[model samples]
Target: MKKQQGLSVIAILLVLALVGAGLMLVFKIVPVYTEYGDVKNALTALSAETNVGEQTLRQEFDGKANVSGVTSVKGENLMVVAGAGSNYLRAKYQREVPLFGNVSLLFHFDTQAGQPPAQ
Candidate 1:
């Protein structure tokens, strides 16, 4: 009998299963990261806005989050720090995406923006 030169049926099925799982993970994860990017941008924009107080900044951030569909961090949870006559904004949050059944992926994001004091 001629020797087999290609993958067996079982081997092919296993490879296909792995590839499918990888694609599924990618599909589930990319959107979460995209949302994180939007959150970062929102924080940075709020930091740069002139003449906005802490409460106003929190409100604006909430508005931005609503518009961007970011559900991880609410305006009430944002950390506002006062330093050297300036305000700083920090956002620390986490997102969870289900992979399969009870399995899930957790992602944490921390972002901060503000001016630094002179050296």
Candidate 2:
């Protein structure tokens, strides 16, 4: 009986551990996907904005939006940039790990090309 009880406890603990990991991935990784999804929708709006090709499109727009977990904090610039002579849009972003260790989500939008980046 004692051995059975111990095994049961261990099994329960294992299950809990698995659940915790799932939650962490859900909470952490899901947001990244969610933010990216929003950015994806935004990209649909940007197809006409590109004077170059899809390579440039992906380079300049797709996977290039500067996004984080929360708002009101400074983050890296992950914008897709267009270069000269077949230079297409490319993903570009700045990586800024919080010094204070506070994670923030920020989204940067470059509304106009060949102009100053806004937000």
Candidate 3:
């Protein structure tokens, strides 16, 4: 009987620990990873428009690294350009404290000068 009770108690404690760890990871690491991915995507998109369109993107967070880049490359079959512009560029990069910080970026977004957002 005591052995069974002890086993049950151990199981409960293990479950609680797992939950706590999950919460911490969720609040910390996720946001930063997300922000990084977003930056990559936005830059890629901005590079697509070339000299013709105004791209608007948001900075994910306001911090020391709140920076965005734009570049263009020409290939035999495809031309690639990506990055946001001054008038239309915007984004919010957020680093959640613990776990969620790794993936806090809610989304990666970029827009051309004329088209509207998808519904």
The per-prediction tally of clashing pairs is 0, 19, 45
lDDT of 3: 0.39
What are the per-residue Cα lDDT tens digits for candidate 1 across 10-119?
99999999999899988998899898888889887877777667788899889999999988899889887545445678888888888777999999888888863346
Total backbone collisions, model 3: 45
Taken over the whole model, the C-alpha lDDT of each candidate is 0.83, 0.44, 0.39
Q: In candidate 1, which residue ranges exceed 4 Å CA deviation?
A: 82-86, 116-119
* Alpha carbon deviation, residue 80, candidate 2 (Å): 6.5
Better of 1 and 2 by TM-score: 1
**Candidate 1 root-mean-square deviation in Å:** 2.8
lDDT of 3 by residue, 25-66 (tens): 676555556555645455445444434433122222121134
In order of appearance, the predictions have TM-scores of 0.85, 0.41, 0.37
Q: Largest TM-score belongs to which candidate?
A: 1
Identify the superior model by lDDT, candidate 1 or candidate 2.
Answer: 1
